[model samples]
Target: MPTSQIAPFRLLRWFAGLSAIVIVLIAWANAWVVSSFLADHLFQREAAVSRDFVQNVLVSDGSINYLTHPDDPELQRSFYKSIEHLSKMHDVLRTNVYGRDKLMLWSTTQSLVGQRFDDNDELVDALQNELVVHAGRITPEIRPKDEYAGLSPRANYFMEIYIPVTLPGTGEVVGVVELYKAPLALTQAVQEGDREVAVAAVVGALALFLSLFWLVRRADRTMREQHTQLLEAETMAAIGELASSVAHNIRNPLASIRSAAELSLESPEDHGAESARDIIGDVDRISARITELLRLSRTGASAIQPTDMVALLQDCVADHQNTFRRRQQELVLDSQVTQAVCTVDAHLLQQVLHSVLANASEAMPDGKRCQIRVSEASRKTVRIEVSDSGAGITPEVLKDVFRPFFTTKPQGLGLGLPLAKRIVEGFGGQMTIDSQPGVGTTVRIDLPKA
Candidate 1:
């Protein structure tokens, strides 16, 4: 496909990809927050249950004295019985009781008793009378010892909780209780929360994407319609300009021919030949104007040839020398570059040059000087300048000098400069004019070198 046709699709793809990534990131973040909150809630519930069991059942009747003296066979047997019953009821995997020095004083896993856990963050928090919960895979450092290691179906994915044991009435933390349990229920709750968050995010993001896509498509369609209307308007305007130019150019010559015929009819004895010549001249002028219009209407069908610039300019100047003499204008030709050659339609370029010289001469009808300068503008282009010192043009009038059917002179058709500019441009050249109110006007034409 063309790039213009594919650009919008590429843009949409980029927007969709970026939006999808952003939505997924946002959803993942929300899911993580929900899961953390759900997991924490479950862990706190388990910790609370463990705290109640410790306070009401295990240490209710001054069992702390028995825990402090674990060497007593009677107290140890009683403690083991209570722990075993609680473990069976709660489905807890392992339990440990830590004393003030963070040393394990009792455990359902008997082998873990008497071990110290000084560096555990959860143990530290419990010693400060705070409950803490940790979830996820078991680390080698804190895994249970001996046969208790593989007691749960998925022993690795377990919850480790710490609950502080406070003294009744004193509210002082004297010991910490650590509990390990399977996290199957907690995982199910967190997954449910994550699923809810994911659904909400997907729905919201999709709605937003669809809304934006529809708006852009609507705007694109509106722009395309506006563009088509603008092109039609421009085509109509061009046709109007051509019609206006034709009428303006033909009106003057037809009026001149009509006047000559009337004069010849009224006085045929003395002015017969002169009136016939005047009619013929008017007819020729009309024919030339029609030819100019046809040339402007045609596309690039004219053959381009390399022409000697110096010889061409001399011939154009010679043809207009008689008009310059009648106006008493001094015409100066300034050629700086030797062997200046360019590719152009020689006849069309000569006509353009003649029009410019005629305009300059008309601007200075009282015999002021006009200069034509020819030089190499660059290695690839040649420049020609026609400058005249006259009652120069005002900035306001100069602005419309190139508009068709706009004229400063009462009898002017105003097609000369515009047609000249068009002809030059058609040959891959440019024409420009500079004028000052008191300093006169200069027209420059730049054409590519052959």
Candidate 2:
């Protein structure tokens, strides 16, 4: 495919890829933030629940007294029964009571009771009256069974909470309550929230990607159209230069051939004098066509000079008056500007006007009326209109009338209007044509005043 066709798709792909990357980054960041928030929220809720359980249910004046003096079998049995009942109510996998010395005073796992945990950070923090919460792999000694036998395999995923138990009516730290929670519901909620956030992020990213893709595709399409137009303009410019060079090369030979034919026609006694005359006529026509092409190719380098508009128009009309008269057509000149002076290349302007006149004459081959009107179109500009009462150009044909080498007539070279348009534009003027089939055609030229 051409670069023009491929460039847009490449740009679209680049935009899509970049958007996808951005979406992934945004989604990851969103998920991280949401997960962190949910985790903190769930931990805080569990900590609050554990703190209440320790203060209201596990640590009371009687419980603290019984813990201080565990020699009373009835009080110890009551404490154990209370801990066991509370453990069932809450979804607690394991429970441990730690004294001020960081030694396990009692545990639902009776085997761990009386164990000294001097280096335990959770016990140390709890003794300082600070609650500690953590979730991690289960240690072999701390693993729960029996009531939590089904949770043993996932014991590694348990959340352990340590809460301080202060003495009643005093701020003194007495003991600590350690609760290990399964965290199945909390984990499930957090995972569900993460999934929802991921889904939303993906959907939002897809929407944004599609919108950006559409916009990029639209811009790419516009660029491709402009590129194609630029290519066409460049091609036309190259063709104009080529035509100019070819016309220059052919004009000399055409002149030589016409001259030789004219010399042969001068021989009245020559048997083929008529053929010689025909040859001369054909050569002259070819020479005229080549001259038009040469005019189309030339870029006027001369500075614009002030010229009398009325006199210029009159002179151009007079030059073509003989041809119109010979063909029995009427040529009318109408000027509305009082001081008709404009800045233009006189030679180029004359060529444009003469070409317009020839086209008008040809349009009205039946010797109908052709008119030229000059008027002040604006304060700084003048307008000239050449109109003819003849078979007008069709809409389809009119669109390409200014295109070089596009002619309706069989013998027409078709460079006339295009060359005229070029000359007018070179002087910063504009040229336009308006026509309707079977009605008439009008050519308008607007130029700046001197």
Candidate 3:
């Protein structure tokens, strides 16, 4: 409630003020439009009333006595009565008749019985049967000084219509019927109201624009901060995974070395030489494991190269050909993938295919043939499928198949599927698995086209 305190509530209040300003501006614009329409409607209504008065009342008797003979008392009464009726129908200031000489013979106001209106040529022309209607400044010189009696000093802002009055019997023009109506007051009032509305509308529009701009700015900043936080979190997760693997992988080699050293210590006389040899072997194994970890972590290690996909797949299947034969299993390769060339790292991709194939072969029951299917799924990708006829992985096992360190085999490290996933993703590809418990399992690797 303080005048200077700026809190979150105050900020939100500022936004509301902006919205209010926009609302005011829109309201003002609508007001202006309505005012303009009303003004136009008023003018049209005034004009229509003036026209109807002349057409129905002034010319109703069909006698031009009011114009031809102003002294004819009988005809004069009818004219005065007609003027009275017209005056009743509208807010008419005055109505009068002018002759060829430009003298006001008669008027609704008895005071202007014989005043001369011989000033403007347009009025003169109207007396000569040239019906004229004009709306603008009126001067005393043109419209006899007494004509503006009982009217505003701004009477010049009035709109007057002059219509030729003709005799009923003969089609001869006798004089003119002039009708006066002022609109300055109404127009000015409406115009003043419009100015207020316009001010409100402008203020509202500015406030709304400012509010939207600030809100968007705030949202953009929040989004950017969130994006940065997400990136950091992802980076930390990767580091954590790397750290875990480093500890786990190093433990095995370190354990092997410790065992070799302990054995040598226990039998230092005869088995010491053999123990030393075992130590060297342990060190070599640890070095190899380190190399494998480094390979897995290296960035851009699987950069693509244009190579024959069919040839690479052929090599992978050939390597497993012996394994299949030794296990008394059949390895059938569908060689319909002749035209399949792709951009890929030949060695890394071969490793992925070979791993899937080896898994497929191992998954099958002894003497069961594992069918290997390789072909182009489309022009943009090559689909390599390895399906085994053996009992497939169960739902629980399939769920964690691709997880790091998850394995079903007795002597397996459970790292094969995860590594395969990494290698495939590195090449901008995907590997998917589908299996049924009692049926068979199919591992499909979809690779990008060359």
Candidate 4:
């Protein structure tokens, strides 16, 4: 069944969209939080300033004289003169001074003076030795068109504070001082701070988003690479099955040909004997090739076992003796470890070593030497090095050496290096090659120690 796939980069696009939404939400939350914090802060600060201002301005000239002589013309004149000017300050919208009995002693509004209001919650709280503060604002959208007609936004913003006035030089309960002010400085400060908090929130969120975006993008790239490798692996597996079947079918006829050649070689007619020997060699080579194909076809199912790598390396060298002699190549084994053990499928490991040896031998068509070395790579790993003293591969060819079906030899199936690499990786090992054009080539494999 065919399945549809989303276009590439869809994940990134989705992430960008989601991040933008998240940042916007963060901005709103920051604005609301900052606004509430600033409001509470301003209330506390303004309450303190109002209580102190009223206390000082009221008693700086005289003390209890006004509280007892509210109707006395002389003291009234003094009290009126002392506080009347404060109400006219730019931010002060109105001011009311209440006596201890809750009678309004003085106010910015002349008519409100001497009036008693018992039901005002803020005023009642103030009379109880507590300060009360309330803030209200009318935006243009909610303004009463006729009542708040000519009011500026600054005028629309107001703070009402009811403070308990304490007697000078003592904590005596005196009266309540109420101030309703526009609080221009506080209003503007809050607006500016809210903006800054929102900006900071967005900047921080974007930084986090970008960091996450980069990591996800890298993961997506890795996933794509793995997907490509999976497709190649599936294709190779299909081809391997077909090649195995062909190799199996050819083995019977190939064996019959080898038996006939062997019988003819015993005829002892010189030329016929020589030809039979050559035919027999060709048949044996073909049989070996078929065996390699069959081995590769059985690849993914290799059984794993704890193996002594030193012994395995020695066996690999011994097994390649016939190929070494036939190809006019010398094989040498060097080990720094007597027994480096690892967990791997023994047959697969042998197949890989054989492939490496054969490639190394074939590199020096005119005859050369190949070396295999086993040593401890680290406390937890064993390293195997296969070096060939043949004219090395070119940089262009070297890069593609492990690609499936890529080879320099006419008869090469091109699966050797790639298969070797796959098998090594399945054994929890890594394989790499280093080649210098005129010097030589070396293949390194590192596996975890058992």
Candidate 5:
């Protein structure tokens, strides 16, 4: 209910966890859909551009007829005219005629007019059976380093084309016509598209991440504030229940002591002297018990501190050793523990140990073995086990063990174990009990590393 008991750490952690999940989903979605689509589109567009470039290299009908038929010189003239007509429709760059032997018979470009292309299988195949040879960049096998170096002196440069030429007059079999171009242009286009997709994905992911982070963090802050208020309210309610009982138990004695002291002041005689001393002692003892009850006021869970496990349990043991001895009880201590370093409140933790010890001591009527063991469970936690060979708790009693003032003993105003559980839990530790009807009972406290 009060504003002073709020914590934000829990809320922040929740928000961070959720925001991470959302960002990952966004990134995966972009990769699966947006990026893939862009890549496919770029490849298709590049392939189309290469195809268009190949169609613009027609110059003569003779070249066309030579591709369509080997022995069709008559129709070759009409094919040459057709090629010239096709050339006029688009921007013609260069036209070259190659024989079946792959030598350049004629070329519109003066520089390549007499060039021999016999070694180029793409050209030879197109001239022979008019096979359309579409060649892109030469592979490593086709252009080994030494061989490619002697030919073109650079890598990643090539073209693609359907060459159209002729066989002997079976019909007009178009020779292979290569629409050749440098791979650099197409590759660059594809790479640029990829870069754009990458940039978009990064930008989109960052935007989504930031937005989700902010929203989640804001929600977490609000949730944390609400959770804090809830915990404080719970603590106040628990303390209130215990406080009412404590106030009721101590007030009667306090009033009796006050009335007796005032009466003793008036008398100052032998009759009141002994009675006064008895009343004062009783009041002092009751006040001590009330102080212990007041300490049970829950403060929710606090951060754990690094504490010495051995020393912590030993201190409680030493403090209660005399009480046990006075009752003729056997007190044993074992320090063979796995984990030593733990985070806990020194004062509150000691109180928990003392409370368990006192309860164990009271369980035995005459004398019994009260054993305390401190050992390590794992690297991150220390385990403290306090066991007693006394009248163990029954099922009915165990059910109400931590309920305030649910005492089995006639003289008990039971808030001890409940307060201890609260204290341990507040420090991110666990308190548990295992008991039998008659044999014994063990209380285990597991504290985490600092």
Candidate 6:
């Protein structure tokens, strides 16, 4: 395998990179849209104020009637006199009034007074009753050198607004009121709006990225858990198939052997009776091993519910009483808690108890003591302890006790302890075994309290 394949790209880094790209793009787009909107909004407000100034203050006293005969020096003088003082007070660099013929009718700068500006789109649109405001910066290349000369040294930005003057009753366009003013206030307002939009975009982008990261991380964990379960399911399926094959091939022969041995024992002849008895016991042990394999293959967890472990332990002890007596083993039950309730499948819990108890009884062939103790381990859990007074396991054998199909006894299939432990853990419980060589073995099971 290549070195690149040894350490592949992880999901977290991939998602984080993708999230950063997407969030950055979104933030940029939002800033652009909000900035454009704020600039347009401010422009519209300024245009409204300019229109109001032209209609109400400049043309209010019927001086607007002078534009029809715009070439008249007397009318031009009267129009300039009326608006000149007000325009200069408002920081107007230069103003030009254009008639419907696209002729510069009136001007604050004497050089442009008679000039016809037919190429001026702002004046043409305003002549058709449109309110046009063109905003830009003043440069050395600006046209009509007369107006550019009057501009202030500090005022780089300018607002050129065009307002149409109509008759009193009928809404008609006679001439355009064009004003060239410095935009110090508008510049300040736009700068403030840009700062606010930039801050908002950054905060919003961070929030979105964090949310996406959290959701992706949660999904990654869920995927890993599902993958582990799929592997476990495939393993169990393979084991089930093997167990089925072994049982199909070996069970019938073992049964026939056992039956033949029993028949020979029934006969009066004692010649081969002892050997027949031995053969019968061996066949029965093989059959027991086969049955254990079948059970192990079919093992799975059932839903857990509240169960009174005191009654469960008593019932398990009672069920094995006759068997224990035949083996000459002493069974004792001791409990600190009377009604120790735990969350587990009742049938599966009984099976676990049976396996451990049977193992304990089988450990001592010469009638030794075996005890079961129940107690509340904590507010959240209940504990069951099973100890046997038999030849305890050595350290080497003890470590492998819960390993599947690992055993020391001659006929042991070695699935009992492993199966028991699996059943206990299936319902969110724990099982542990402690043993000292030549002393005894004690198994403890802890289950969550209901």
Give the winner by TM-score: 4
Rank list by TM-score: 4, 6, 2, 1, 5, 3
- Model 3 agreement with the true structure over 1-450: per-residue lDDT tens digits: 669855434444565677666676677668778766755565556666565557556566843566666778888888777766765443366777677677876677778778887677777777676656555555666555564555655444566777676655575777777777665565465566667667666776666677776886687668766875576446445644674588577867676787767677677487477767777777767665555455455534466788887777677778888999998999887866666877778877776777787787877877988877878888898888888888889999997887665788875756667777767766778889999987889999888987
- Cα deviation in Å at residue 326, candidate 6? 26
TM-score of candidate 2 to 2 decimals:
0.55
- Using Cα atoms with residue i matched to residue i, what is each candidate's TM-score against the true structure? 0.48, 0.55, 0.42, 0.61, 0.44, 0.60
Better of 3 and 5 by TM-score: 5
Q: List the residue pairs that clash in candidate 2.
A: none
Candidate 6 on 403-440: residue-level lDDT in tens? 66688878676778877877787878999999987889
Compose the digit string of candidate 1's lDDT tens values, residues 210-253: 78777766777688768755764464357446755876778676
lDDT of 5 by residue, 63-121 (tens): 44455355677766665565444333222233455555555544545577457775786
Worst 10 residues of 1 by lDDT: 147-156
> Which pairs clash (backbone N, Cα, C closer than 3 Å) in model 4?
none
What is each predicted model's overall lDDT from 0 to 1? Answer: 0.75, 0.79, 0.70, 0.81, 0.66, 0.81
Please identify model 3 stretches exceeding 4 Å from their true place: 1-292
Q: Compared with the true structure, what per-residue lDDT tens digits does model 4 show for residues 1-450?
A: 999987666676787788778877876787788778877787689768877877787778773367766778887788777677667666776788888888998897789987999878778888788978888775767566543444456654678889787766677767887887777677777677767877777788778778888988898879987986797688578768867787868888988998998888778576788888888999888887777667667777988889999999999999997888887788889999889999999989998998898788877765788889999999999999999988898999987887777888888878888889888998999999999977899999999998
Q: Residue by residue across 30-51, what tens digits does model 2's lDDT show? A: 8788777877777778788778
Best by lDDT: 4
Whichever of 2 and 6 has more lDDT, that candidate is 6
